[model samples]
Target: MALIQTSLIWVAYAVAVVLLLIIATVFVFIYQTPRDRAVSVTTVCIFTMSALLATVLLMPVDIALVSSTSNSAEGRKKDWATPNEIDSIIKTLKIVYYTLYSLDALLCLLVVPFTYFYYEEYDEEATEVGDQTLGTRLWGAFKYTIAFIILVVAIFLIGFFVPYAKQAKNDGRLDLDYFQRLLLQNRGERALSFALGLLMTLGTIIYVLYTGAGLALLPVALIKSAPTVSAPTLAANTASQLEENRERQRQLDGRNEGRENGLESRDRRELEALIREERTLIRRERLAAESSGEDRHWLIKAWIKVEAVFRPLKLIGGLLLLLLALFVFVSMFITAVDKAKNSICGAHCGYILGYLNIFQPINYIFVKSSKVFPIDYILFLLLVLFLFSASVVGIATVGIRFLWITVFKIRKGHTSPQALLMATVMLTLITLAINYSVAMLVAPQYATFGHQTFCDRAPRHPGEQPDCTHNHKAIRPCTEMSKNAVAKDVCTPSVLSTFINGVTIDFPFFGLIMFWAQFAFLGVYLVVFVATLFKTPKMDEDQLDADLEEDEEEGLLASTGKRFGATWQDITGHARTPNYGAAETNGERA
Candidate 1:
């Protein structure tokens, strides 16, 4: 029986890993595929798919932790024909967990970093690899991978190892044995990991909140936003835009071409901008010309129609996703606060999903869901996927948001190889953060869908389709339990609670961080949402209004004073100076 269950678990894992590979391959192919196809697509797929999968190896281990925390595994032990079977299953779980853990260390710390550089070396846009021989490129990527390893080690030292060393009072050893579950052995590492994960998780939260707001509001705004395009001027518009772009490019070339570092820094950036614009207009012109009456091919017309539908569908879907994400955030926030306040569960307390279990009050509706068997599990998985997909979307978009956004000044798009490397590293960190985010989202849906919880079979297996209250706790509190089928010490948590204690196995401080930091993340999210909601959406119109307001606010001499602010002369003399520039050149003509 143990072997059968173990084999089934591995089979499920295999299916999941394959699905992840497909998803990872599609993402990498879209984002990181070499522009210059010197490397085969097949090879890139194989390498990148392997790297992403290898880096993300802790899923099953964490799931096991969740199972243990809920005491579901203890409940499952009753089914074993022999007492040894429980031990056998546990031993198997530990073996698989450590195997993946060690392999993850090997691949994530060593192999994955090189994969990015090796792939990036073939990118024509990455000028750092310009004109280098294959051997030179290979050597550079190797050096880069080493540097990345050193950086990871340094972070490990600061975040985990140093603290662990101090706590253990053993200078030579570090707590690399991460096979812990709610045990307080390596508190330092857990706290630090929790902190780092908290920071990135907040970043992920902001990403989702803002994206959701934008997505929710975009579709209607877009449908109403009609551009004033002249039918006859399509070709003329492209020509003029291209000509203007080239003119700027020509000016930049002439100014910088003679310098030692030709077209470096901002000049290089401006040139690239010009080139991109030129290409965009050229493509637009071709498409516009082709679309003239019968000149448009049937394929082109079909694509155009498809795009019309596809664009709206995408936007609508984003809006729906945003709603779901907001609900998840609220649920998490509630769960955090409840855990911080209550500390431990009593009565029927273990698996609190907070707002995530909206279906609890209406349990009668889904009371029969347990009877659905595999269907119930499937539905539960779908809910998990939806919540998790939101987190993935947030991680994916966070880097892009940071890349493009600014506070006081406009940010130039990241076009340099250095920026590329930085983004990749950020991607790496956020990928780690996804585990925490997804874990936070996943625990709740089990209650919603009426899937089995620890209390489901507690105290002599109360009917299969148990209510949230019964499923949340056994017949009595752990302290009061006597002659019960469930373990005496394992307190079953209430399904009504948003977050269960001991849920976050590795990052034990996660609940506390979430509770304290709720203000910061939620505050930022609210600020962004409110500002976006009330503020003008049209940039050009806002700019025009501001310009007109500025012109109106100007006085004869005060306009100059406002422009440059109070000058040294004005400050020193205590004299309200007239427009200094205007006064200096007052009746002069060029």
Candidate 2:
């Protein structure tokens, strides 16, 4: 029965793999169209999906391998695959996932510049089609070559600062003893992180409150500063708008009138339809031409602005992201190495695999609160996972918006103040919400999953499975095992114990590394966005006034606050007396 079940699992895995291949083929077909300008985003999405699909497929294979054991006739245990073979396969799969994730991140970074350059090139070509000198073209090509060289150099410099090669010296293995000692040596770092996070949180709250109050008072300020327009000017402006609307109405009526002038009813209907279709086609062509012209104009302006503004930021942003990625990569390598050396079941190796898991919300907070707020370890882990999902999904929502902007050529909206404000609010909210959620939901459920899963296992021996609870579950769970624990019991509170200022604490090394890495990425994003906001242009006075007027006309807001006399009249349901001579003349004119 077991053998049959294992065979079914393998078959299911094969079917899933085949389905993934078919989906990939479909993506390939979609990518082949020349007019499919969304290819970049589509390609990245498909590749990331494929990576996730592959990871899911490999998980079942791992489970099957772990569960497949045979009983021998001589009363000895046998296995289908050796531990070494299974470990090798698991490690290889892990490497594949890690590489896919890194590539996905790199693609995200690359898309911004690539999209900018693409539109710039398109604009240049559109301009140079009819009248471009050879010298000018050559100069353009020369500049492009220089820019490409600089981009390559920039990427290299960014990668150089990552320290990956240094960490890889010990085959990416993390020495727990060395790490613990380093923690003691660098006590100031942990304190600084906590201090910075707390300060930032308070600062953000204060800023929000202050800003909200200011916005609430803005209408009063606007009312006080409202400009006065003469009655004749207002009337003239209103008359001009009315005249424009009348003209449009006349044109629409003329079309209807023309349609009614036909002889036969069927012929009249068909002819009217044909004429309407022709008019529609012409209108569409005109609109498309105007749109293309506008796009070309804006593309040139945007490209110039991008160069003047964001080009300077590229090096700084790249370096920051690079450093953060490397930090995460090193931490992941360390975790994997520790798990392998300890011979823990790969399924229970930390919370998740690769640097992607670092983006999860679970972190040092759980470790810090576990002692003070106790609960089931399994429940705590699940809560952490849930928070991780929510936070990552929120971040991805913003990311997808960016992808859409690039793919759809929505460059004009990219640097708007409203967009920047929204981005800031969303990011800040996500950060705060995740921290609070983890504290409230996950922290209270914290138990000794780490110790139970790692410590209470049997000693390593030849031809024997490692002390993995999942592999050999005759050993009691951590909760039961730790209850009767003595000084000699393996069910200790900590898995990788460390000293912080001579105080022993169960150091959540993986969690802290990931948490800091997240902060580093957020820091880079915040700096870049704030800088961009500063660089972006504001609407001129005329445009601002026009927008305000439109909003007021649409009943969105009051143009001006009423005076005290008017307010009193409104409250009392009273009418003000008018000048009799002026009123008599106005009535006669009407």
Candidate 3:
């Protein structure tokens, strides 16, 4: 227990370090790329806020948890923190976590589906940029952002509050129902808020659709827009074309002279056919190369590769989550049945309620001591089988798919070796999380009981006196009976209590361990994923977006202002400033 506690403390420290590193990295990027001021600011704010929230909210929980676990295990009465303090910290953590969870879901709902529509509109040019009003776009963006925020808050209530309310109702320690009542009242308020928010979001969308505008305007207002392409300089292009024609004419003239001199006689029809074929092939290649396409940075390519591999795993995940939910439901059923049987039986075969008699045999075979065929054991075996089967199927399928994706994406120049290296690390971490969760569920049941011993009064004891210091009050012989006996308590208390208490403590810790472990793993994973996917340094080499390069060059002047004490206000003005060069060039093309 001490070792485990110590290990957990270290793990917490590791988590803190990792989170701090992420915060530092975000700030560093913001500092380095003042040109991407809007984007960098948004990124910094989100991450900084998240980190602050985590630190303030989770630190206390960690402290309380460590103290509680250590004191409880050592049987100490001293209080580093009271139970109330611990409970409060945990409650706060849950509230904040769930709130953030709702926001995450809200973002997904708003961004992903709408993004598809936005792209479709952009591709078709359904709404001409020149025709759209700036005020309309800004108003639409603001309305939707507000609506999403409100709707997310409402979602937080519906998803988290109702369930927590139900749970609190069962908590015997809560001396008053006042808090629970408050929660119910708040739920109603949140529901109302949610409705209003939904209406606002929908209303804005409808108005936009009616006005023949696109949701593309909303994201464009929020996130930085892609650099617009400018027209080619005609003078330079014409000059280059003329030069190329002159060179071609010279080559033709040389070929004619050679033929006239009879030094190089050839089939004229075949030569013309070959020249036509060559020109057609060159034209096709040039067209393919000139097609408008987004840049594929290393990280984006890596993601594309990873997505191809894990696309099928979405179905696998759904199946696994469904199976896990079923398992939990069955476990709950077993628990309820056990509780009911125990209550009616009263730790002995006392007169059970008549209605409950139907399940008496089930109680006996499963919950009770005696079993004819170990039906309960068979249930345990089935659980094991299912767990093993599900894990094996998931891991094997994902691994095989990853290998295929790696090979395929590498061939397509979409995945780098470094990306695969990071991917392998991710897989290992995922495996650890999955296996650890499963083991936590199953390991306690088969834990070793304390050393065997016979009480002094028992026969065939070989004269070896049992150490019943912890079990003396509970130990009794089988023959010692009365009209009713509490058969459940007829065990060595030392061993039984140790086993029972350990398992009990492990149950909640399972969730706690899984939470923080995944938290740390994901922090690392996101850093690697994002660094590989986006970021300017890694992307510049691709040269996929010529306009993007120009934007960066223009941004250099804005970034320089940062060194001379320019504020966000200054950066904002700079972003709004039009690039007359680009606009004039585009006008020429028009």
Candidate 4:
């Protein structure tokens, strides 16, 4: 039966993998297209559907494994049998589910980078049609490579530490049976479960909160400012300009009609001619005025003024996001400090020691409070804000620069594409540094708190002294606890290892690394776009003439070459022109 079940599990895994691959291939094909409104909508729909299906399929396996072995008997004997089997299965399922979910998250994050890349490449290809420059493309490739390296390192460290922290929580639960024994003698398992549960639950909550907050900020930052001119406004302006021109033409025609009526026969003829000339002059004036007005309306200078007015709004939005992210960071730090204190002193030590110990008062506050606030939540929120702020700053900087370039026609001195590529690299590096610093600062808190719990478990080991327990007679020394209890207990080495592994994989550190890498790519693209805006190639008059002449010469050569290559009858038949000499002779004979 076990073998059959295992085989079934593998079959399910295979199906899921195949489905995911198919979905990913579809996305890849769509991603290769240039950005368009329809494509964006379609991409979002595809991603959401794929993720939903993957989640639905994944949840069943997790539920089945967890539910099947949840009530199994515990002991060394059981450890070698059903209990260990169940635990192993549950752990495997959890890891698999988390990994797939992370992949889902990654795919969603990838949309931005893919769009940016497509747009940038299209722009480059379109602009550099005649003179291909390899510098920008090469530099972009180099920047992506660097970003990928940073991402890998960050993910590795996150994956390494998270499991260790979870293991500490599981290990601390080893004294559960001992607590149950004490309970039969009128004691309780409250202390042991509380100690273990606090670390695991709190650590998870913190990580989730921080990650959620960070992700939430991305969309807010991306909200485009309301368009400066709506379609209706443009239409109204066009109608008004047309009306003004028509009124001027009508007045000119009335004046010409009056002059035409007051003349003698010869004078009247000349007057009619004068009226015709005057009407033409009026038409020319009307056309000149209309063209001038249209030019003024569409000038780059006008758009710059509009952008300038919107600048403050963007700055305000960006600053708010930054502040929110900063708040999350500070909150995470505080939570970490509290958790560390709790783990070191044990669950209720803060309450007992707080009045007596001035240095450790904070721990008491954390314990007596019914809810331990999650620092990670704050960190996640801050991350969201940070991303939002960074995006805003990036857009604003590029937008302003572009506006100036367009309005003022600023000259870019060099034709080197390398300059734009370098700017992109710099921007990407800056984004990575910022994200890394944030993660590093937040990760240590989770690690420190988790570690503190592991240390507290040391004293609870089977061989330790029994001074800590309330009932001396009822409690055996740590040394007296059976090997079976140590092996099969929740706090056993195996359980601890499993728990640590779980926590490490659950946190948002990996996601953050992926996000920052993509952000770096975006930054590079933005730099390229801004550089392109400022640099307009000088129009080569001589080159333009030479190109035109070359085209004419090619046409002439192609005609001659085709005629020469043709058979004589075919060439002569098509070469016959109008027989003008024959027509002239016929007319003379007639």
Clashes of each: 11, 0, 2, 20
By summed lDDT, the worst window of 10 consecutive residues in model 1 runs over 406-415
TM-score of each: 0.52, 0.32, 0.29, 0.28
Q: Tens-digit lDDT track for model 3 on 1-590?
A: 43454355445545654654464343233222222223323343334333322322232223223233222222221233345543453454446434543343343344322322322223224246454454554455455456555755666565334323333334443222211222333444344333323332332222212111111111111122221221112122323433444455456556678454532434344345445434533443332222111243333333333433343344344345444434433332343343345322221211111122122222222222111112333443334333323322222222223333522111122223222222222222232233222222222112111111123333225633233445465343221111112211121112211212222122222233332332343333234334422532212133333433433444421121111112221222222222235343211221
Give every collision pair in model 3. 299-532, 299-533
User: What tens-digit string does per-residue lDDT give for candidate 2 at 134-245?
Assistant: 4554455455556655654454444334222222123223333322232332333333323223323432342233222222222222222222222223333334433443
Stretches of model 3 off by over 4 angstroms after superposition: 1-69, 72-78, 95-99, 102-106, 109-134, 142-590
User: Model 1: per-residue lDDT, tens digit, 308-423?
Assistant: 33442454554565565465556556555544454332112222233232332212222234333333334334444553343333333233344456211111111233233333
When sorted by lDDT, best at the front, the candidate numbers are 1, 4, 2, 3
Q: By TM-score, is 2 or 3 better?
A: 2
Native-to-model Cα distance after best TM-score fit, residue 325 in candidate 3, in Å: 23
Predicted structure with the largest lDDT when compared to the true one:
1
In terms of lDDT, which candidate is stronger, 1 or 4? 1
Each prediction's whole-model lDDT (CA): 0.40, 0.33, 0.31, 0.33
- Poorest stretch of ten by lDDT in candidate 4: 348-357
